[model samples]
Target: MGFKNFRFQVVLRVALLVVSIFLFFRLDFKSQYVGTQLALGILIAVQTVWLIVFIERTTERLIKFLNTIKYDDFSENFSSRGEGKIFDELYQRYNEVIRKFRDVRSEKEATAQYFQSVVQHIGIGIITFKKSGEVQLINNAAKRLIQVPSLSRVDHLSAEAPELAKQLLALPAGQSTVIKLWQGKERIPVALYVVDLVLRGEDFRLASIQNIQRELEEKEMEAWQNLIRVLTHEIMNSVTPISSLAGSVAADVQDYLEAQPGEQIVLQREETEDMCMALQTIEKRSQGLVRFVHDFRSMASVPTPKKQLFEVQEMFRQLQMLFQEELLQANILFLIDCRPEGLKVLADRQLLEQVMINLIRNAIHALADQPNKTLQLDAFSDPDSRVVIQVSDNGTGIAEEAQEQIFLPFYTTKATGSGIGLSLSKQIVRAHKGTLTVSSELGKGTAFTLRF
Candidate 1:
């Protein structure tokens, strides 16, 4: 009953089968009585059946073990009894291996559940997807940011914003892009950052999206309030002295006029003239200050945009008509090109037109009397489906130091400039859910780009 190895067990079963068959044939030829032959045949049949069962028992146990492993069923333990020493050892190893697998699986599931909870509760929106646009995971924040209850793919965003969907699909890993989303009447700015990763041998992109509209507005308000404080301080300093001086000068002049007859006027003619000159100077400076305040007010009080779809070509045509005479007189070659024929953008026509005019006017000033004066305007859509409008001119380029603060209120390099034009234009573009940027090289040219 006890075998040293698995091969010895198999060989013993085969030998028993061969001996039973040989005896069965011999008994058939030698048996003479009916009862005897019947008994011998019954004995041979029982032995053959026992040998088949014994040989098949190991195979059956192996099949059961494999099934348990496939099903991750760890409740059943392998028995190391009733078989030979080799089978006892094999069953013991199987039991130990199954126990190890159970422990590993439990730990893995616990770890996975922990990370899942963390991912779900994070503040920022997160989504993971394959290159084919199949969404793998989406957190609650992502659903709220996207304004969707369930998302299966990135292209689903096309229903709300076509450009946004395109950008999301084509966004490169390790890069970030800002997109504008409109919820009712409010516009939200979402910043998206993507990273490439591989999970279980499959490539995926993980993106984190966060709304930055409120933050930007807060910072902008803070900047404006600071500027207002400075403006108030400067206006008070200038106005108080001007008012006091005006009042004093008027009092002196009135006293001189009311002097008694024959009494030498307390104010000499020279002193009276000096007072008059001082009043004139104050008046001039006050008027200049008034103009400055007016410009600032204009910049601060930009109205909310009334958006409408308009063709870029039509706008360009209007620009040509508006600037043709001036460009011709100044001997500046002005060119406008709208690629893809009649590209259009959704924005406030009047506001965008004002921005373009400000940029072109600045270019004209830079190009004044400069040789080979050329101004170019281009309108087209970028690869990410954003509408881009560029104004480039070969003029006295913006100095590197000045370019950084060009969009700040009251920052100007020109003595006669109000410094609000470029800043106002920048605010207008930002309000329209766009960006305005500038690139310039010394003595080469300056180019301004508006992307929406």
Candidate 2:
């Protein structure tokens, strides 16, 4: 129905062509002039040419419209300009298709932008990379967290943090690992979790990175406080009573021996002596037990650090003075190094001094059996600009099993160790928002690192 005009034009052209051809054939060329016969033939040829051009014109326009769609060229606006009903409707359909395509493209772009903003603004660091280590996307959070200048590949992080880069590459999907690295003056305990991703049949891995140092410190403090509370309550309850009863028994023994006639039965010399000895042993052990368990209260009651800026060299000098006699007598070489000489730390001076003393004493004890004793005390800034103090000794290193339990209270490998020094040192560092770590291998040596 829309092609009504077109059908009429086609029928009219066919009728004219047929009539012209018939007349050309019916015309008697023999009687007619040569000029008239030539004119008829020319008319017929013109009508045929017109008809072919008319048909080709419509086909050409239709092909152009389809090409426009195939190439997603929504800018093409088909305007028939009243050519005919057929072309008018065809042009309208083309315009409608282009309009819909434009709408779909706009919607797709908007959706992409929305998600792009979301990924960029998210708090957690995100890194999307290919299996070959080529990084596809690294959000702002990731850049800041990693402190990377420009990340093109995941391996590029090796320059700044080798262990973190290695762990990220080796980590499988749904697996996570925590790495401790310093950032500026703060220590960042980064937790990395990997997820498998396949976009358009291309396999990729997404890693979520977060600084869990605060979370870890919080949890550690909570665990220590909980254990300390339990030990304090239980040990004090059991040991305090034993100590009191032992004291009362000792007094009662003396009373029994000195009792006058009728007050109590007088003990003979040997009996009195045996009872006195038994009471003294009981009293001594009970008092010792009470004091041993009372140490947990110190952990639970660690005061907030009284922070002040202090120089590491000055502190080292004082420590050297304090340990001068012990170090010389043992013939252990003590080396103190402070990079930039003015290296300073903001912390509770006395508390940190205490931690350093504990580490040095442990080093001294460890170096006792080694013939060539060397102890290094170093204070410097790490690659990340964080303050680091190290106490390393060339002595018999701790066993792997003991290393794990070294920070635990009342657990020690040394026969004379109180088992609380390392634990307390760790707590004191925690109060300063720092970490105390030990790395040792059997037959090699031991190093205690303080990172703040």
- Point out the worst 10-residue segment of candidate 2 by lDDT: 180-189
Q: Write the per-residue lDDT of candidate 1 for residues 1-452, one digit (tens) a residue.
A: 35745667668767876775666676666546556656657877777777678668768878888888899887778886556667788899889888898899999999999988888888788999998889989998777777788889889888876766787778888899998775432346899889999989998989998988657755874587478667856876878888888888888777766774555666568897899898898889899878877877777677899999999989988988899898898999998889977799999999999998999889988899688999999999975589999999999888877876787888887888878898889888888878777778779989898888
Local lDDT at 386 for model 2? 82
TM-scores, all models, native as reference: 0.57, 0.64
lDDT of 2 by residue, 1-452 (tens): 43346777798889999998888777777664668778889998999999999889878877887887788777888876555776788889879988998999899999999988999899788998899999988888788788876799878878788887897789888999988665642346789999988899999999999988667767877898998888777776776666676777678766775776475586689867776776777778777766776677777787789999999999999999999999999999999999979999999999999999999999999999999999999999976578999999999999878876788888988997878889889989988888887788787789888988
- lDDT score of residue 200 within candidate 1: 91
Tally clashes: model 2.
Answer: 0
Report the Cα lDDT for candidate 2: 0.84
TM-score, candidate number 2:
0.64
TM-score of 1: 0.57
